[model samples]
Target: MVEGEGVTARQASFGGRGARLLLRWCAVSCWLVVPIPAVVLFTTDVPWWAGVPIQALVLLLILPIGIALWFDADQHREDTGRLLRAGRPAVAEVVELELVDPGDGSADTAVLRLRISGDDVPPFEATYRGSADPEFRPGALLHATVDPADNLFVLRNLHRS
Candidate 1:
């Protein structure tokens, strides 16, 4: 809706695009690209004296990702702040829930069905993910805010422990 909302979201997402790129390179280094160079360098047996330079070089080449991730975080706060500042208030009722675990190292996700209604706003049902507050149960009422321009909403309370 607004030109800067995307910018705000991005900047707030990872201290902005530059930082995001840096972190992406970090994830790349940590999980993706490092193996390529690692294989190339260590494929052959090397003398004990060479191990220090090999490790140093690898660490030097691989450290940017760590720097990048230092700036990235779960970005709910940015959206939450934006919505709370100007978005319309609403209440969300938890209608149903399903927990989906990918079985990877990633966080387990909670899929929720919610019914949201507020003054001057028609009721609506939507499926939301676990970024919402953690403690909601079926039939629970939770605070929410809707960005009128986009109808994007965020649950106001922090999710569970």
Candidate 2:
């Protein structure tokens, strides 16, 4: 095998469309995190004023942070895609997939470990962090864009189905 033999896959949890949906869900869910606490405090007579500050913090700070984090994560993935595109490596196959449990909130997304090999290339593993639906199973064919400049970038995105 070649010295730089590996595979890369696109990280697809929340693409542009998915990100929009996440934002909307976050907006709707944000109320539950703060409002519920405030209401309970007020009703239970545990100093409703104390809950006001907490609610303010959640609305003014937590919500914004969550939204920003979500966007940042999506942007990072896009940047990776661009990097792969710029590198321009040959396509590879996702020969194997091993999913590691992600302890994050996005349980729907799976963590993928790929096995790749090519002639004149040394086999290697590339771990891709992305969320695919639970329905995505092993041995699913995925197209990868490789970075010729850096063969280590065996995994990249052109398209996947």
Candidate 3:
């Protein structure tokens, strides 16, 4: 989770690539779903004056939602790339954990408060969802990375050996 500086970037509990794909699909679907029926209705039965305004209203409502999803996906992609390319390893102790039940019968998620150990790095928290790992329990040591520019943007490399 990225905090401070007025913009907080939270890493999704789910996989970042999965989230990006879902967002991209949703944005594309919005373009296909909302406008096609709208166009057909306007051309077949609606008057020009009424149809134009209605179309404009619908576009105004949905465009922002689509744009926001796309922007978020793009941001996630950029962050993931950056983290993979330039992130440095740091040992982090699990200081806290909050288990969250998604309520859909999926595995529970653990929200972690990690105290990163090293010089020039500060403690931060991140929420992760998936099957519970005993390695992530409080006081357990885990491998993680901190964004060089902002220590708050910590990325836990779950696959670390």
Candidate 4:
């Protein structure tokens, strides 16, 4: 997205717990089915083909989780774009944004301290992005285009930084 003037700019937020929950769900479902096939194979002389249905069932169950993960990524990008496209053209002075990773790489996030008002005024801090920015400092202001609807997003402008 183009860095326009009014929107707030920052990095993306990571989905830490949500991703874990999905992964766990996938794991548990797979585990639950593992024994069923073993039990069927050992106890019954029924053809090995009997287990195909069980495997298919497991696959069908996990499909939604996979679909949700894809949708999640798409939604994130869309939301980020929406924030970038929201407000009037304004430049928000950048401040040091801290990033935290909750082990599951997806939850890594950055909290940027932004000067919403004037340079001398107190700045606002919000959690927005999920990655690290080596160039940003405590007082270094970055030129960002913000959307008034949500001023927390900033279209990344490498040239201005």
TM-score of each: 0.48, 0.43, 0.62, 0.44
Residue runs of model 3 more than 4 Å from their true location after superposition: 1-22, 43-62, 102-107, 119-134, 152-154, 158-161
The reply for model 4, stretches above 4 Å from the true place, is 1-61, 73-77, 80-85, 94-96, 101-109, 117-125, 157-161
Model 2 whole-model lDDT (C-alpha atoms): 0.54
Count of steric clashes across candidates, in order? 4, 9, 0, 26
For each candidate, the alpha-carbon lDDT, in order, equals 0.60, 0.54, 0.66, 0.53
lDDT of 4 by residue, 1-161 (tens): 44333544344422345665665565566556556765776788867787678756756775565666566655555555554445333445556567777687575565666665323222344434535666565776655444444444453532232
lDDT for 118 in candidate 1 is: 72
Q: Would you list the rank order by TM-score, best first?
A: 3, 1, 4, 2
Which pairs, if any, clash in model 1? Answer: 26-65, 133-159, 134-159, 134-160
How large is the C-alpha RMSD of every model relative to the true structure? 9.1, 6.9, 5.4, 9.9
Please state the error at residue 69 of candidate 1 in Å.
7.6
TM-score pick, better of 2 and 4: 4
lDDT of 1 by residue, 62-146 (tens): 6665554543532534555566565677788889988888788787788888887677334666677764346767999987766
Report the poorest 10 consecutive residues by lDDT, candidate 2: 6-15
Considering lDDT, which of the candidate structures 1 and 4 is the better prediction for this target?
A: 1
Point to the candidate with the largest lDDT: 3
How many angstroms is residue 123 displaced in model 3 relative to the true structure, after the best TM-score fit? Answer: 5.1
Model 1 is weakest, by summed lDDT over 10 consecutive residues, at: 6-15
